[model samples]
Target: MPTNQIEVLGHAISNGKGVQLNLDIAKLHTRTKIQVPIIVERAKKEGPTILITAGIHGNEINGVEIVRQLVSKKYNKPECGMVICIPVVNVFGFLNQKRQFPDGRDLNRVFPGSPRGSLASRFAYHIIKEIVPLVDYCIDFHTGGDGRFNIPQIRINEGDEETLQLAKVFAPEFIVQTGHRDKSFRHTLHKLDKKVLLFEGGKSLHIDDAVSKAGVSGALRVMQHLGIRDFSKELESMDAKIKKPKVVKSSSWIRATYSGMFHPFVKLGSKVSKGDVLGSISDPFGYFERNVKARFPGYVICINESPIVNQGDGVLHISRD
Candidate 1:
């Protein structure tokens, strides 16, 4: 493929510095069209092509912010190779502040999509066809959904050697060796022979400065390690370590036994043992109270921030080892 070729589907630019591309999507209205924003910067010399994707889930604003800051301010002028940043992959959901698209589809779940399928499926297909093949590695960013927060962590396949090394380069406080689900973006990328790192932190619709900063810094560190940039002089060694993350083969939601006000005793990232009182559900009238206890030892990766809760509503998510 030519470096600076522009097609009806997308526009590519090669300005000696690098190549930037903008992909157009199928339109619903004449005036409004959804587009996948992509910017690729390839240096004069040869190097790795790293894909940085954010907003896979529309509500994950921290990742989007991190990628924006990275491309516009940090990696605008690169030392070598290419850095491809896709700031918002799910524009429809983002506009409405919803996690899934109006079509009631989770874009992340429909990876390696089909060309002649549903709207979300077509979008996913275009990404796999036009983007994934051009990259050597990838970093997908995400966060906890509405009313939930997560501690900064990197999730990668346990057996992939290159992925494990890249996860360490990310320097997140926790390295989660997770299993891949069918049709997930990470799983699809792995099938395509790309080493993609997943970073989860903060919460939806909220800005956690610490999470955002850590995300950007970690990305830069990965770029540096890949020989894309030389930041040793200007950047300090991060204190982040690769701890044996609380491994959870599977997690279940803790539902409220009764409807009432919720008062969480523990926050995200806190470890809890079995029988620990995680929180309490109390009636607004203060006549009745129920204690929410952990059924197993694990980390509290996500908790409800909303004060109000109803019977059978999910209150906390525990990931057990």
Candidate 2:
């Protein structure tokens, strides 16, 4: 729907106005109220409404940082459409630097959630019911779970030509064609016929300057592409150069064979050939070591940065084709 008049978090927002609302759906066990701030900005000219969200997983501070930069730099203020920024969607996880809700549930797995379900589910339900309906397209930011560091990339389903095209416009380092999680926000939005660009970058609990730049620049490019605003001057000022994104059709993870201290050898976003030495695992005392080689040729998009590893732990993510 064209964004002229809309209501976000129960407040009516008219054209050319901005409002900050709190999604105070729940409180902590300490009885202290926690507010998930939702920032909404609408242009006088009616156009598509785009929802920019991050912090679905509380530990993914890189995602939160990306959205924060957008809001802080006023990049979310569009000239033709409505822009909604939810910098911290899962405040509970963010506050504790955890990955799940207070009820120990991953919020991303509970899309279109039940009002009568878990804490995460109820919050998810509210998001879909109250905010998502007004959104036309969405950019959900994320980062690698655990300690895996992902290069800047946009994840989309293989056949979504429109979203794939838009992902190209975002100009991240990579575009990964991957299936959606069963009940993820991306899947739910897809079911509702809303296009979503799921961006993955950096790692959880940490923020990288390059990744933040990529995330912000990509959003600017998307908004500019949609005619929501002209970011010509802003784009010129951005330091992260537009990447010729490599569309990854398939990918796989390189698991550690022997539990030991892990070290990755290849640079992220670089192509690798079969049998290449990607990394090594060794005993802490330097008594045992094993070289991890690439099984097939692909690009290294993610690496496990943790210094320790276990048997069968995924240490690197490489594209198959």
CA RMSD of all predictions:
3.1, 1.2
Candidate 1 local lDDT, 204-276, one digit each (tens): 9888888987788788778889888886654455444334444444666789988899999997778899999
List candidate 1 segments past 4 Å from native.
1-16, 237-253
Clashing pairs in 1: none
The digit string of per-residue lDDT tens for model 2 on 1-321 reads 445467788798888999999998877788877689999999989888899999999999999999999999999898998999999998978989999988899999999999999888989999999999989999999999998999999999779999999999999889999887899999999999999999999999998999999999999999999989999898897765777889999999999999999988889988999999999999999799999999999999999999999999999999998
Tell me the spans in candidate 2 whose CA falls farther than 4 Å from its real position.
1-4
TM-score of each: 0.88, 0.97
Global local distance difference test of model 2: 0.92
Give the best candidate by lDDT: 2
Q: How close is candidate 2 to the true structure, as a TM-score?
A: 0.97
Model 1: ten consecutive residues of lowest lDDT: 1-10
Candidate 1, residue 122: Cα displacement in angstroms equals: 1.2
Report how far residue 132 has shifted in candidate 2, in Å. 0.3
